[model samples]
Target: MYALEKPQNFHRGTSFSLITRNGDDRSETSDYTSEDEGTEDYRRGGYHAVRIGDTFKHGRYVVQSKLGWGHFSTVWLAWDTQKSIYVALKVQKSAQHYTEAAMDEITILKQIAEGDPEDKKCVVKLLDHFKHSGPNGQHVCMVFEYLGDNLLTLIKYSDYRGIPLHMVKEICFHILVGLDYLHRQLSIIHTDLKPENILLLSMIDPSKDPRRTGAPLILPSSKSKIVSESEVSKDAKASCSDLTKNQKKKIRKKAKRAARKCIGKEEADQDIEVSSPEASHRDDKSNGEPSEEKSRNSVGENSNNDEANDASEGSRGHKRGSRSARQKLLAEVELKCKLVDFGNACWTYKQFTSDIQTRQYRCPEVILGSKYSTSADMWSLACICFELATGDVLFDPHSGDNYDRDEVALGGRYSRDFFNRFGDLRHIRRLRFWPLNKVLKEKYEFREQDATEMADFLVQILDFVPEKRMTAAQCLNHPWISVGPRQLAPSMSENGGSDKKQETDEREAMEVRVGNMAIDGAKNGKDSKSMASPLKQ
Candidate 1:
């Protein structure tokens, strides 16, 4: 079929009527069995493709193609013809149809973006907002800069081969920058931080590329460049088949160019006889340094690094750098991490009133029924930071059921695994919300030998007591977070030995207290309901 070619004089700024010569009226939604749809719908189902050339203008942004949709609004890949760039359009299905939670989210997003300078940059930029009438009613549309895949996609495609340490750090640091902006600057709380929400500006490499390492970048061909307003108007009037073919060709060319570019200048110019062997050896050595760290990070696999790039496109550049340079780069990264997502960040004092993040990344404070603030964000930062360094999540539960309600209502795996490891904590000190002894017996059958290992990591962070959990600042000082002296744990004090010991002791005590409280409540009639844990949707 021949594509409809429109007149070149069509201006983007002017309003134009879109006449449908042929309309295929079809609507079939797959409503799953589960009623809860916070963010899991995308995972459980497929996203609907927008009708090609069906134009919807929101202020300066003209809706192009539907990218994805969630509970509150539908996300569209759009063009800001005036700015000459591609942007994400989040249009509300209908203003009147919005739930109270959805309305609150919209207001919170606006406040965070427009509230503080630091917060503004951390969030996905809000370019414009407008009202449009859908078949149902009036809708609210928001425009944002379009980003590529999220962290989850990057990790899934990583070939089960871990991501480079530096790249992991880069992603974590960037997220922190955004988190800090939200918690510290704007006093907002994200309540949600997971692989899905973390979007990549560009694809480090195509999903099919052979080279899987090196600096992250987009295939030049895949790189979105602004099309002229006239061209966009003409194209918007074209048919679906025509647009799909153009997009495919555009992707293929970009992939080829990306492959050519993957041939590093150093590797490309080296002597053919020995260079390949030498280069391979160097890569191995770099990979060697982070092995232990990677294992520790992988224990849970909460992080999904496949969201940002495809493993098919491997690394090609320098692997490890000098300690000094690495430290400097790490510091610079920590400083810049304030750029990722600030629209819904919260401070230590802020209470995260809404369910915003993915299940795993949600902090224990958020999980247990505690008020959210910077501390909660710090927890998320630590999780992401760990993922960056090791390519894994810290406490991702294996079972699919919502652990929050299960833990409270039925006292989950702690019945078997926890007590079996820690032995009966009957003789241990009073924990915050639980009965120390009863909980030990009823939950994880605590063994004497299990206490040490159990007390070491997970229990400390997932303390069930929000106040007792470590803050991101505290995590920055932990050995797991640091590599060595002003070298590894640069965020910590090397010389303040006694002070560090005291702080550690205090944290330990807090953990014990919180544990006791939870167990005690379980034993008694008192409510141990925490504000940290979330209600399953």
Candidate 2:
């Protein structure tokens, strides 16, 4: 993914194939400290085998740099000659079997775009889509507006410690907003919701388009549009990515000298810079917690030690004082995020698999072989929330899984706790089940009220029966979320004010109920539908 060969198009012993490396900006280039020792073992037709600076679709877009890769495709940060800006190009794996999911994704994205153009409500925007033929085979390609690194990367940049609660709340809130839009407005099921797919929105200033200034940059296939000098440097680094290590160092040195000359400075006094916008791919070997790779080539690690130390202090202080110092930074930065990778997404009207969700996030309904709806997505969100909060999975059943599966480590005995609630699945005696609040208190060290509130919210969504679980809309409206932390929601406030007059009428007219059927039956021999916690009116 990082190379800088001199020839416009030449093969390298280390690089995968012949690349058309053209541009020559290296101010942001880092010296090569790591080697591709095992890259030769990759198959010739593999996704990572593509050369840098490769043009596709009649050279409408020029490959700039490899953004990252996935099991089914490799993504590159490419320059759009047509749009005069950088964009993300995803090339699907050569295998045609993966085509079905890609096509489905395209359809879902288009439908979502058509439904709500303004719904920057928190879903990634698909700018364009097309296909390309390569020696391997015909590969489907997608174009997306270049966005900042994914949440997994950001978490690593912040170190393995849990993020401040305010930032975490905002992130989770944005996720729920996106989920609400998909589940309510589009009726689309994400199927997958993990940190990897949660990406921060664009970092580029949208108000400025670089290509208006005329510049004589010649190319046969590419139709060069005039762009600002700042962006020019960025695109140049992408094209010259195939240069050798010494070549990169020399080029960078010369560029810095030229920059210093322009400003009449004797020397470039800054540390070697990494101009690439993308952060390093997350270190996946840490069981489940995210960690940054400390390899010399990794971006962002060397840029700032003060910020890391500050974050550490801020996190500790926030824990003690109950307010995050970085909350304003998150808001000011407009740190919006969106869900990507609709490859596994399916329409509510169309069903793909009876089994859905990654194993750890799987809801009880699917585990019990019962039919599931969008509520399955809700379950996954609950699991993701727990993971984000505690840096651990909530309900992993396997020892080999990346998330912690042992409940005893979480301070609870799983068998004793769950058997009472789910044991009836085997058609045995139905013991009284433990409440979610009790479980949270036992399994975690959170404050009592905090545990109670979280458990209350989770309990509504984690119902043993699928039909009883809170829907996405219900989740959005839950007091724990909508009420703004510890404050009471206006509608649920004690005063029977005019604002809540209608709500009070409806609620008072509504009959009050309590207890699950099993508990009620055990006490009074009455079979009844359970009433979860009352809405705090």
Top candidate, metric TM-score: 2
Mark the 10 consecutive residues where model 2 has the least summed lDDT.
309-318
Task: Give one digit per residue, the lDDT tens place, for model 2 in 347-402.
Answer: 88897876565554666555544567778888777766655544444543422212
Evaluate residue 372 in candidate 1 and report its C-alpha lDDT on the 0 to 100 scale.
59
Number of clashes in every candidate structure?
Answer: 89, 11
Return model 1's CA RMSD, one decimal: 21.3
| True-vs-predicted CA distance for residue 17, candidate 1, Å | 55
Task: Give the residue spans of candidate 1 off by over 4 A.
Answer: 1-50, 95-103, 115-121, 206-357, 388-392, 398-405, 408-464, 468-470, 473-537
lDDT of 1 by residue, 1-537 (tens): 101112122111111111111111111222311122223222212211122112345223433334444444445554443454556666554534353333555666676667654533545666566555533345565666555555544443432222333355445545655665565566666655655566665443333221222312111111111222223333444433455777866755555455434323322332211112113332222221100011111111111222211110111122224533433333332222223333344444644444434434555444334455556655555455434322344333221122221232111333342133455322112223332222222222233332222233324454445577665444444444334222333222111111123354554565577577667766787644322211111
Q: Give the 10-residue window scoring lowest on summed lDDT in candidate 1.
A: 290-299
TM-score of each: 0.46, 0.55
Global Cα lDDT for candidate 2: 0.48
User: Residue 100 CA error for candidate 2 (Å)?
Assistant: 2.4
